[model samples]
Target: MTVFEQRRQALKESLRVRGLPALLVSHAANRWYLSGFELADSQCNESAGWLVITAHGGDTLLTDPRFEEAARRVWSDEIVIYSSRKMEVVGAFLKSLNPPALGFEPRSLCVRDYERLREFVALTPTEGLVEDLRVIKDADEIRRMEASCVLNERVMLALPERLVPGMTEAQASWEVERLFREGGASGLAFPTIVGAGVNAALPHAEPGQDRLPAQGLVLVDAGGRLDAYCSDQTRTFWLGSEPSDRFRHVLALVREAQRRAIEYIRPGAPIAESYHLVRRFFEEHGVADRFTHGLGHGVGLETHEAPSLSSQSRDVFRPGMVVTVEPGLYWPDWGGVRWEHMVLVTEDGCRVL
Candidate 1:
């Protein structure tokens, strides 16, 4: 069977096991994962298409006329065109199926749409039916992920040399975009975060007018999308020949924390342990509170997916899963350091991409 068929079959089996007659897939990535449709949703409020798959058998791709030809190319047998009011057409299609219950992802559907969709049928709000399958990467997916990571690293490593003193954060951000395209990436997985000096303290700080200093920290968090897969990475660079004693010590700790956490990544290892391990390491240094966000997240068709690595995550390591391992210490009004890399969970351990 084709990969798409295999994916749908797996999802169908899940539906049968859960006693769901049909599943309404509205998430853009989930739709692409099952149907091989590439056009992305322009916005969360606006959908490019939707997929209705039954438990026992049958499926249909519902899209507007603008994407009729594109949708038909991926799903030839059943393509329903709706010029406007997608939920209205979708309600009619579900009524025609006449299933006792219909499943949908609550995270994907807006509240108003959900209220509208339920008026026509019994709505079952399902979570992670498609996402659970996405966490594990197939062999082909691994290849694409590997290639994408290679592209991301190439751009990341090259940027330091090109960055000149007095370059604005926004200008540096543009350089990152250019490098990704130069490396033949389809696009960025997320907005390139270029923060220098005190700005680095804001983990998700948007690139701004802050200029690169001759002797301070420059933190870059970036990702590139390629072959339908995504790559995430981060690194902090020192502008001068040497960094301050405190900066060196902090960077060392973060690197060591990242290394130890990665070594602990393997099949059957609780996903949350990795984050706590780093937390403990930082706590020993009395900087645990400074280590703000989660350790990392799974990366694939989406930069962030399932099986997260954090104190709150309940996932476990599984072979064929790809995730990022980023650890850092940030101080407001001061420079920060974050080191990140993508790792593929394997039979024995993990491979840094």
Candidate 2:
């Protein structure tokens, strides 16, 4: 069977084991994962498309005319086109089958759709039916992700040459996006962050018109996507001839924390351990509170996915899982320092991408 068919079969088996008759999949990513169909949803309220899969391995795509042709080209046999009355069409199909129970992704379906769908058939909320499968990358998926990572590193390494002393943060951000496209990337995984000096204190700081500081630090967090797979990385650069003693120390600590966390990754290790390891390291250094946010998260078709690395996460490291290890320290007065690395979980340990 093809990869897409295999994925569909796996999901079907999960539904069968759970005693579910069918599933109504609304998440765009989950739809692409199962059917090889890719379409961007304009907003949370707008759906690019939806998939209805039966427990016995039957599959169908319900989409508007705007995406009908493309869906047909990708999944010809299973395409259903409807301009309006989306729920009416779906209800007609469900009524014909009249299965024991119907499952749906609660997180993806909006309230109106969910309430309307329930009026036709009993709806059972299911979580991570497809996402659990996504967390584990197959051989082919790993290859595509590696290609994205290589391109991201190349773009990052070449930035020093393009960043002039007086360049504005917004200008630098634009250059990063341009470089991603020129470097053979399909697009950026997320908005490029180009924070200089005090601006770096905000972890997700928006790139502004503020000019680069005469001296101090510039922190860049960026990534590129290739073939829908994503790569994420971050680094802090010293802009002056030399950094202050405190600045150097904070950078060293963050780097060490990131390095240790990455080295600790191994199959079966609890994901929360990675977060605590970094937290403990920072706590020992008396800056534990400064280490804000989770340690890292899984990366793939989406920049962030399952198997999060954080104090509250319950996931365990498993082979074929790709995740980022980013640890940072933020100080209002001193700005911030962050270092990130992408690693692929393997049987024994992980390979840094």
Candidate 3:
């Protein structure tokens, strides 16, 4: 079955088990998953669009008149489009049905939207009912995500050749983005990180006007999206002479840790085990405290999603799951080194794409 059908079936089962009469998916990602209609373009258009799935297998696509044609073009026949000035129209429709319970995404909906929803109908906050349903990838979603990964890999392979010593970080970032678009990416999954020398120490550092160091480290962390799926990667390079022995040691350890983490991942393995394996590798290298971030996270329609692979996460690795294995070490005065690769969880082992 298609992803939309799988999602509908999952939510239908949840509603049945939870005794909810229907669910009102207000989050754009959930709505898109349920109805196959992407309303992101209409986020700022003052149109309160939503996807409603009834326990009785009824699916409706609620939107303002402006999106009537667009919604019709993309959604299935079961999708019932409605014209509305505000989301209250949907709440009013649901109230008229007098359903016993209306489900809302507690994690994605804001306090303001929650209050507004309360003004219209009774809402029961639900955590991860829909997001959990999205954790597993169907054949189609994985295909799209793999395509995104391929695009990202190609873009990164091309990026190193463009790095000139005099170019500012911002200029280098722009070049990478241009290459991404030219290589068939829909857009960037996240803000590109182009940090040179000490700036590379900041894991989430932003691209700036600082010039690239003549003989130091240059870290490029970037990703691109295709068909709403995303890929994230980080690669650090040397500009001139070989890096110092200290830098080389850190770089080698980081890469080895990332490799070991990927090798240790398997179906039914606790994610924490893989995290600790990488942590132990860092600790053995005497840079354990320098590693500040978790090992990795799920990559999908959203850059960071579910099934996080970290030291504290309790999720067990499962087949059909996509995650990144990124291990790094940073020093404020010096620089950081991280090597990240996306992988797919499998029955016997994991495969890096």
Candidate 4:
């Protein structure tokens, strides 16, 4: 069967086990995962389309009139177009089903939409049904992700050649984006972050017009998307000269933490174990609080996905999973250092992408 078909069958079984006759998939990522329909909304409130999948293998795509032409080209399933009153159209569809239990993604839908949906059917709130299935990548998915990762790595490798001291952070960020596009990436996985000096302390700092430091850290976190798969990597580089003793020490600690985290990745390994390894290393160095964010997250259709690597995460690693191992230490006065790399979880261990 086609990959989309196989995914649909898997989702069907999940719905069956949950005693749900049908599922209303609203998230763009989940929609794409199920039907291979490639469309996204500009904001959380907006929706390009929604999918209604039945246990009997029926797939119906509901979209607005604006997306009618594009939907027709991408989706071969039943297509319904709604104008102003989306709830009315959706309600009609659910009424036709008369399902005793209809599954819907509470995390994906707004309260207003969920409340409206409740008026039409007995809605069952579900989370991660599709995301759980997406954690494990297929061979084709891995191929696309690997290509993206290769493009990302190439862009980083050429940084020394293109980057110069005093170049604006915004300029450097644009250059990285250009490399991704020129190298055949569909688009950026996330905004190219080029943080230098004190600005680097902000983990998700936006690129600014500030000039690159003459001799300190420049943290670059970038990614590209190829065929809807995402590649994410971050590297901290010293400008002009070698880093200070403290900065160098922190960098070494972070790198070691990241190395141990990546080494701990394998099928059946608890996701939290990798995270704890990094946390413990930072704690041992008396900089535990400096590490602010989670170790990493699953990367694929979205830059961040399921099976998060965090202390609170109960998820376990599985073969074919692509995840990042990023350990960082931040200081407002001294700047921040982060090292990120993508790895594919294998049966025994993991392969650095």
**Every model's TM-score:** 0.98, 0.97, 0.94, 0.96
Candidate 1 per-residue C-alpha lDDT over 1-353 given as tens digits, one digit per residue, 9 for 90 to 100: 77988999999999999999999999999999999985479876789888998998788998898888888777865888887677788788888899999999989888998898887899998999999999999999999999999998898889879777799999999999999998999899999998899999999989999899998889999998998899999999888777888889999999999999999999999999999999999999999999999999999988888877878887799999999999989999797899999999999999999
Per residue, candidate 2 scores C-alpha lDDT tens digits across 1-353 of 87888998999999889888899889988899888887347787888789999988568898898888788877854677767888898788777778767899988888988888787898899999999999999999999999999988998898887776789999989999999999888888989998898888889989998888767788899998888888999988877677889888998999899889989999999999999999999999999999999999999988889989989988899999999999999988778999998999999999998
Query: Ranking by TM-score, best first?
Result: 1, 2, 4, 3
Task: Mark the regions of model 4 whose C-alpha exceeds 4 Å error after superposition.
Answer: none
User: Clashing pairs in model 2?
Assistant: none
- Please tell me which predicted candidate would have the highest lDDT against the true structure: 1
Candidate 1 Cα errors over 4 Å, as ranges:
none
For candidate 1, the per-residue lDDT at 168 reads: 97
Residue-wise C-alpha lDDT for candidate 4, range 1-353, written one tens digit per residue:
87888999999998888777998999898998888775467787789889999987578999898888888876787998988999999898888888887888988899999889889999888888899899999999999999899999999999876677899999999999999999999889899898999998999989999999788889999999888889999999888777799788988999999988887888898899888988888888799999999999889999998778889988788899899889899999978999999999987889999
- Candidate 1 vs candidate 2: the lDDT winner is 1
**Could you give me the TM-score of model 1 versus the true structure?**
0.98
lDDT measured at residue 214 in model 3 versus the true structure, 0 to 100: 82
Off by over 4 Å in 3: 39-48, 77-84
lDDT of each: 0.91, 0.88, 0.83, 0.89
The candidate maximizing TM-score is 1
Q: What shift in Å separates residue 9 of candidate 2 from its native position after superposition?
A: 0.6
